[model samples]
Target: MGQKKRFLLRLDEKLYETVEKWSADELRSVNAQIEYLLTEAVKKAGRWKQEQGQSEKE
Candidate 1:
């Protein structure tokens, strides 16, 4: 693993609640859940660098 960058994120109350529930169901923290979703989206869009593994983006 690499050092993670941190920043502030603000979400609508309803959206946050939905993500909270989904995160629980998936047994991941809210932050991890969001990261997972974004990673999948990037892969689907052909933006993830498969040769470099999941942590790299292109």
Candidate 2:
């Protein structure tokens, strides 16, 4: 098991709708889309971390 962090985000109606559509198209829940976006952002910003469980065995 892992710890969880919670955060609140605010978005305009139009942006929200876009994300809703994207989530549906990708078969992901709204929460999942947000998490995916955050993960990408962190990686792009060079602040993301790869968990040991997620690493490929060498």
Candidate 3:
């Protein structure tokens, strides 16, 4: 693991509410849910590099 970059993200109200609900259902914070979604998209696009000793499932 490494230090995570931080930035402000502005989302549409409806979209935020949707993500909030989804995050609760998944037992993850909104931030975690967003990161997870982004990671999955990247992997699906073959744009994510797997770190040493890290499985794709991670």
Candidate 4:
């Protein structure tokens, strides 16, 4: 299991409300929704990490 880290984050009021609504619709907590968004953004930008030798091992 990976360790969880805590940090304070700031958001614009409008963006925060938008995320809250999206979170409710997706049945995820606000924090989870933010994480999901970040992950997806990274994926689309080709910034997501890859495990070393993952394909070869598989």
- Candidate of highest lDDT: 3
Off by over 4 Å in 4: 52-58
lDDT of 3 by residue, 1-58 (tens): 6999999999999999999999999999999999999988998999999899998776
How would you encode candidate 4's per-residue C-alpha lDDT over 2-56 as one tens digit per residue? 5768899999999999999999999999999998899789878999776775652
Candidate 1, lDDT over the whole model = 0.87
| Local lDDT at 55 for model 2 | 58
Q: Count the backbone clashes (under 3 Å) in each candidate.
A: 0, 0, 0, 0
Task: Give the TM-score (vs. native) of candidate 1.
Answer: 0.80
Top-TM-score structure, candidate number? 3
Q: What TM-score would you give candidate 2 relative to the actual structure? A: 0.76
Residue-level lDDT for 18 in candidate 1? 99
Candidate 2 residue-wise lDDT, 4-54, digit = tens: 788898999999999999999999998899888887887889996666778
Q: 2 or 4, which is superior by lDDT?
A: 4
Q: Ranking under TM-score, best-scoring first?
A: 3, 1, 4, 2
Give the Cα lDDT of each candidate.
0.87, 0.83, 0.95, 0.86
Candidate scoring better on TM-score of 2 and 3: 3
Q: Who is ahead in lDDT, 3 or 4? A: 3
Local lDDT at 24 for model 4 = 100
Give RMSD (Å) of candidate 1 vs. truth. 3.7
Q: Candidate 4 lDDT (Cα, whole model)?
A: 0.86
At residue 16, candidate 1 shows an lDDT of 94
Model 4 scores a TM of: 0.79
